[model samples]
Target: MAQLLVTGGAGYIGSHLVLDLLLAGHDVVVVDDLSTGHHLALTRVAELAGRGCRFVHADIADVATVASALDGVDAVFHLAAFKLVTESMVAPERYFRNNVAGTAALLEAMVRAGVTRLVYSSSAAVYGPQPDAPISEDAQLNPESPYGVSKAQGETMLSWMCARRGWAATSLRYFNPVGTHHSGRIGQPQRDAAALAPRVLNALQHADQPLTVYGTDWPTPDGTCLRDYIHIADLNRAHLLALQVLLPGQHGIFNVGSGRPHSVREVLASCRRVTGREVPTTDGPRRDGDMARSTADASRFHAATGFIATGTLDDMLASAWTWAAHNPAGYAT
Candidate 1:
């Protein structure tokens, strides 16, 4: 079994990925700042995996701390970043400092510790509003928000690092990650969630609050934003596959998505079908950096690794509903 270090192993995706790695019989050491992550999620991961992983409560930018965490590690999965588009528009500096500078620091720490393998958690926002339905990796990266730019910048840094330092790095440009594990042990934290799925689910929990459908006049079939939503399980599995196939002196960038577009209204409808409850929504103006349509043509990744996202919209909603129903306060309970 390989020894791995996940930089953000307590967040929604990180927690799930750590669980998968542990179940796959890898020794994992998670280093997270707990800025947007929960310690409880790691606790639950340990419980579900029937094994415990080492946790270092520190930031990835902390070179000394992260270097120490990298001791005896084989590779690193970098998933620690600020991901809110709206927030990034208002506070671009924070996104650059944390996502870009922080990534540079992490890479430096990796070099110091002599662990070269890396799997970066990138985002679909790098594509921005594309006229095309599904965008490929070769598409021009005109990121609309600072958050997207930061992710793209992280990928750029990885490419240079791979070329100069002989690091094997893979960047997975993720689409909207929905759903939860089948066990319902961990899921998105509902409080202050920026994503539509968790916000919609949180609205369902609170009968008085209505889910806000941002920008009903977008250039889409349903007049709402179209997104490529992938199940959390499928996304994590892709990470595992990417980790296994990483090669030295090479850098790979792939889009990880369901390769299908679903509108905001469609997602709400699916939530209703899964929960058998009314999803009250109010129309709102589009937030800055919001995309009209962003799907993924992940054929390249499929050709290279044979990994395809296998979760339908209904399946994603059902798994999310199960997790929300089980963990109302999201690890607080």
Candidate 2:
């Protein structure tokens, strides 16, 4: 069985990936600084899997941690990053340092440790503004925010590193990822998530906390932005698929999305329908570096691996609501 390391394994999607790997009979190691991730979620993951997975409570850029963690890792799922677009806009340097520079250090350690295979958790934000259609793998990357720019630059850095170090890698440019594990034990453990779905859950928990519909004036159906919301289960599955199938010397970049774009209003409606209550929301202007419409074509990745996201928006909203209902204050509860 292969030994794997997940950079953000204490976080939402990475934790799911860890459990998936363990179930597949592989050894998994998680290294997370717990900035936005909850350590309790990792505890629940170990309990649910009924196996003790190795966890190093450290950052990806920590050389000692990276070297120690990379001791026997066959591959890595790099998911650690500062993901909020608005937060990245407010603090671009932090995003660059953590997401880009941190990634560089990790790659160097991987090369030194002779671990090559990697499946990077990238974002569709790398493709800033495209036509109101499915963004193919070849879409020009004009990232509008520092977060997107950092992701784009991360991909470039990976390319160069792979070339120099003879590493094989696949970068999955994911759209909006939502939902929780069916067990409801590990989910979006971050209480202050700026993403749309978690913010809706947060609003539901508190009566006075009105959901901020940021940028309702974007050019789309109902003047709101459109995004592809893939379930966490489906998204993590893609990582496994990439890891299993990618051959050495194969450098691939693919998009991980459902290929169906749902607008903000549509997601809100789904949340309301799932919760059976009107979600209190207040209209707010668009945050800097937000896109109008962005969805993944994913045909290249699908045709290559037959991996199409099967979760619907309704399923995403339902799973999110289930997680929120089960854990009101995230892992704090």
Best by lDDT: 1
Q: Candidate 1 has what TM-score?
A: 0.96
User: TM-scores of the models, in the given order?
Assistant: 0.96, 0.95
Clashing pairs in 1: none
lDDT score, candidate 1, position 194: 83
Clashes of 1: 0
lDDT of 2 by residue, 1-333 (tens): 899999988888888888888888899888899988888887888898889588898988897779888998999899999888878889999999999998988887887788889899889888888864688888888898899999998899888766776678999998889988877788885465678898887877777998888787787869888888898889978988898666676679999898888888898899888889788889999976567877889788898789988887778878888888888878888
- Candidate 1 structure lDDT: 0.91
On residues 98-161, what C-alpha lDDT tens digit does candidate 1 reach at each position? 9999999999899899999999999988888776768999998889889999999999999998
* Candidate 1 worst ten-residue window by lDDT: 125-134
lDDT of the structure predicted as candidate 2: 0.85
